[model samples]
Target: MSFVDRLRELRLDAGVFRRATDRGANESAPSAFIRPRPIESRSSKEQSVGRRQSSNEFSGRRFFSSAAGSPVSRPAVSSPKKVYPTANNSSWTTEAKEPAGERQVIKVGTGVRPDDPPSSLCPKPRSPKLKVGITLMTRKPHRFDWWLRYHRNLGICHVFVHVEDTPELLPLLDSDEFAGFVTVTTGDDNSLDTHNPNSPDNYYTLMQRQEEQVRRSVVSARRMGIQWLFHIDDDELLHLTEPFSRLVRELGSDVTCITFVNIEATPKSLNAECVFEEIDTFSQHLMLAYRNGKSAGRVSVADWHGPHRFTGRYCVVPVERACILHFESCTYEQWRNKFIKHKEMGEAKKNDIPFPFYRDSVTLFQEDPSGGKNEQRWKAFYQERKIEHFEQLHEDEKIRIRLTSCPKQMIDGASGSFCKWRNA
Candidate 1:
């Protein structure tokens, strides 16, 4: 007989089946109390046969009775190890026990298997939509409020400002007005020692400090998860033909940075108090190697020559759709202060360099027969020169000027004297 049949015969002989049936009918009686018939009542032959069969079943090879009533050996069954997904759902790991009692680990994530690739577990990275930041190095706290609002409105994610000799603005930096959006870094008093005679005429030390400031801003922006950074001056504003985010996305992955051409914005009349109110027209001549800023993250800037140049391994966008509205000379007073600041910074002595605006301004001041204090003549000269510059523009330059326009709301409300200009 088969092994199952033999086991059934043994149970019947022991009266275990009869006892189990009786216990089931008497539901009140506990199953544990059921007893097998006394083995003494059975013959010795039957008892010896049962012991031999039980010993054979438990031996090294589990046995089963075949069709011919011969014992057959079968392999032992093994329990399967369970696998679980990780929190990110990217991979899975399972632990299995070995025969030697050591634990074996198995990785079975989406991409971990031989047939799977990294793309199976990890999705293709999408281009960042709105991770751009702006960094400005300025000492003019008066324009900070308006400048901050302008960039914030443009959907810039972060702004880093390096304040030079502007301690009073520190309170605004700490205020909740710009809680997480704006960060301010201050330059030491020694930064103003550009006029020291020991320093080179080109003020290499000052330029180095400015470069360091830009590096810090870039680092901070990267920490904040910013994907692109633009380094602009306080007096300049980036003019975008479309949404900045869309512009960045369309640039594609290959382009690491974009350099925008600069066009000087001249005021029609300096009668207005605010520069934004007075300046309505931009120059037609694009500054070829003038002040330029970049718009990409993770790029290493080895050297910062000026607002227009940097040394690094990055591809520049070929189109000139992005341009900087450079308010180089806003008002007579502002220009005078800027000229003096530039002179002290050793910019006036850099004749070998091609900074047209600086060179022209300094030359005008030096050649002035009235010892540079003739305000009316300075204004007239500036206006005449601006007209001449505008007339020299090519057709393409004219198109750039036509495409650029300042948003009135940028300098409106509490951030600026919008009403004051409106009432005037």
Candidate 2:
């Protein structure tokens, strides 16, 4: 039996997978969970046309709310790790906290360049021009154009965009600013499900689609002669300071991947129409802002921090620099429209999954044959046990923006965000 099948059996054995009406039938039924939307592949030529069409496809918008509430609202937990000794009543031991100063030299390039960058003091040699690949998964044109400009201004030699097959994006794809600097990749909307794994409706096919997307996107960057592959979803944007070129020169060999600041923004009830504003800056970018509080223009989050397994929203292998911005949340209308589009896609495709996955406290996976009842029960139990904690999180919930100059000091093997750390 497949792992999923075994898992289903376990859920039943554990008394969590079935509804009270269910009798653990011998014959399985068609999965009620909708399949996830397919990821856009850079290899697809259709993406080059940048055509927006009306069909049953997922909308990249409105998956989450301004409150960021949704069944998908599971707070990404930190990766597992070894606990370091604490200072309480323990003998003080020491370990090197800072990265070792020495770097291993690595020569980059297929052939020697006429004007190659100088050999680094590190053992490795620098590549010709730093190649960067950028991914944006959105149907909207406004945010797409912004990212294009950022990469071009950053002197990045190449750019790749992943957007749904939509006509609204054609003009921008055809724009002079994007000329020669951009390549559009086609994405299928059918592979965008956000169902919980516990749901019997959750199909292995949906999970595979997501994995394929990550694999294909990374492979495309490798094919493009890009040493660094950066990721930014539709709503997210990256911010950076030093030209990536300078960063390549400085951290050439030691750096492999980079983590960037995640700046969470939301439409706030300002003086007039809802205006998008940053509420929190991840620690990395927080240092970049004027202590006096000035808005540093939007930047790609991939530029600074490396990818955390939990917050894969933005991250990349080392290209030339080490900083970027992430604008994951935007205005409410745009957000709502996104969910509406996804719902339409679901209905047309016959997936029939509810729009937004979570509505009026109902999760998209609630109908899945697996643990649908238990999942609901778990949520209710969580609310009951941690009512105060959940309320505090909701009440204090505000936009978060972070900026970090050095990521190595802030991240551990588990990839937890440590605002401060000392060797012990």
Candidate 3:
């Protein structure tokens, strides 16, 4: 390239730059490039006008300034922030209503939480102040004292006994433990007829009447400051290492009902004089247990009442914190005799009891004085029957087996001599 040509190009570029700079410095544009005009010897009238316009614009617009008493302008109208609510919060569910055509304030925090079912649908959890009612139907008067002492040991304050319909047994009902007895008689809603169900009509009537009575019992318990009403029979007991109150506390509100280990009563020896102590509460209380060789079985001896057990159908609690002690073959000698006589009454005289069947069936009958042999026979028969019954039930449904011959569970456990799951 020639030097003359290069020189001409440079001059042209310089002229263009000078022209651009002149336009910016003219001070007639909407806004000037430089700020704070210098104090010249003489200022143009146009420059003064432009500077005044720029200052007015700056004052009218919004910009943060720390200067005191400065005319602060507000921001221009713009869209609000968008918020998306999540499932962990309730802000979106209970949103505030907004005016028509205006932007709604959709919160971006957690969303709506699900509502739990009503207490009526699901009963509240068990409480420690539960009032338990026990009803035992026994023909023998001597057996009451044993059960009374046993229940006392079990931490029960109230016990209701229902002795069989016998005039001789009425006198003992005056005792403190037996005083709470609800002696169901023919006059009391015709309890005897209810037990002797000939047809479905009879069964229904009996069931309805019994359930009504049970409801009354529950009401009474509630009035006595019992938050939970437990219904149990004579042979049934609640076995818990911790107090009933603790069980309720640990289970919390999730547990509506709890099931316990159903321990069946099986005879340890054939001796009719074999007195079952506290250790027998589980093993020697039921007929199946006697036949099953110190085995345990489930019985519906105890249940809870409140909102939990008040469905159209009985709802068994899902948790296993509580168990029902099912006294399967724990009937007294007189009761066993009475049962045998009643079942065979159709073939025999109404008043004339079947002495042979009664005598053979009841090992612990007052008159059966054969030391251990009679009891042994009863135990053998019971064990055979228990084995048969167990075979009928699924293996998973079988009761836990424990030998009563082992040192008494109560004494051993109390003395720290018992081991978990020990065979002996």
Candidate 4:
């Protein structure tokens, strides 16, 4: 028999028709009393055929049961979908029925992720300003206050001082005038023994100590974020014709050094008590031995041969406007003592042909160790030389004259026009 005929026969035998007929005739029939129709038994071949047909009709379809007690089918999704958390603390996902070719970008959140690129929309941080500092190696504490005041007036922001004699000079560092700006340090305890012939410090040992002190100051300046560093002595005063900061900013990156020629200032009389006060007059002749202008940046102190030049590998830029005013011949007592010290340190042995100034000073000291008659002779010699009045000249004229008066040896291939003044 056919599958449908068999199903009919099985329902009739189970009395399903009687129950359905009774429910239709009585409108008041309870739902609980009305029984469901029993499924009819079928052969394995017939069951397999029915399952195959059902699967075919329901392929790519989903079913939903309605309130009217009927099953409805809708098209099913084909692609997988993902949900992501958004900025408003809510979850969202792409439409399952969206076309495969099109993609919508979802801003995940306002917060940054580990793999996200840095945001260019935000403002960048500002950089710090560059600073400059000066280093001084001073043996005389009495002149410290004066030196500090002079440079501070020239817009010097920071200072590093290495006092040669700390015990006598340490009290000066505590002054209120130098509270925030100045740093005081002591000389090295392991300084060279002047008496030992085999020691490295014996030969130019004083210069060696000065170099070591300067080196330490340079390192300290660098650590403190000082972009430019200048080294000067206690007796030397640097006069900047222009603003020091402007000069530093104008220097090229490749130019690491700046040299200034020295102009020796002599007193009218060797009997003058204070040379600093008598600095109104300066010598017309340029002292080739003392070129001691301050250096640029952090150069090695050992590289500095004298106050005038740096021997290291650097591009040296000479400042025509700025010059170091040296009070090398201040007083009779100071000069005599300085000469004696140099003589004891074997200065005469080192120089085969010493400068006339040194030779004369040593001769006079030898002839009159008391410095009474020698002072008068040196005073007469200085007075005979015509000295230029610094205050009377114009700023440009002073720079021009000094530059013109510089010795050729101090500057490479430099031809000064004031040749007549050298002999005068």
* Candidate No. with top TM-score: 1
Which residue pairs show collisions in model 4? 291-307, 291-308, 292-307, 292-308
Best by lDDT: 1
Tens-place lDDT per residue, model 1, 211-311, is 66667777776677776677777777766543444334433344345555454665555444556545555542333223333333433433344444444
User: TM-score of every model?
Assistant: 0.53, 0.39, 0.42, 0.51
Backbone clash pairs in model 3 (N, Cα, C under 3 Å; residues 3+ apart or in different chains), count: 24
Q: On residues 328-366, what C-alpha lDDT tens digit does candidate 3 reach at each position?
A: 443334234333333322332322222232323433333
- Model 1 lDDT vs. the true structure? 0.47
Clashes of 2: 65
Model 4 poorest 10 in a row by lDDT: 49-58
lDDT of each: 0.47, 0.34, 0.35, 0.44
Task: Give the lowest summed-lDDT range of ten residues in model 3.
Answer: 290-299
How do the candidates rank by TM-score, highest first? 1, 4, 3, 2
Pairs in steric clash, model 1: 292-307, 292-308
Worst 10 residues of 2 by lDDT: 289-298
Candidate 1 error regions (>4 Å): 1-129, 189-206, 286-306, 309-315, 318-320, 342-350, 363-374, 387-424
Query: What C-alpha RMSD separates each model from the true structure?
Result: 31.8, 21.5, 33.7, 38.1
Which of the predicted structures, 1 or 3, would earn the higher lDDT when compared with the native? 1
- Model 2 lDDT per residue over 1-424, tens place: 9999999888887775454324333113111111223334324433312222211122221112223121111122232111111112121211212212221111111111223334443234334665665544455544555555545554445555545546678678878867677766545433334433223333233334334444455555566666665555554444432334433332223334444433223223212121212323222111211111101101222232212221222113221112233333233334333333332123223333221222211232233323246455434422432222222222112223332322322110111221222111
For model 2, the local distance difference test gives: 0.34
Which stretches in model 3 have alpha-carbon errors above 4 Å? 1-132, 135-142, 176-209, 270-275, 278-322, 330-335, 341-423
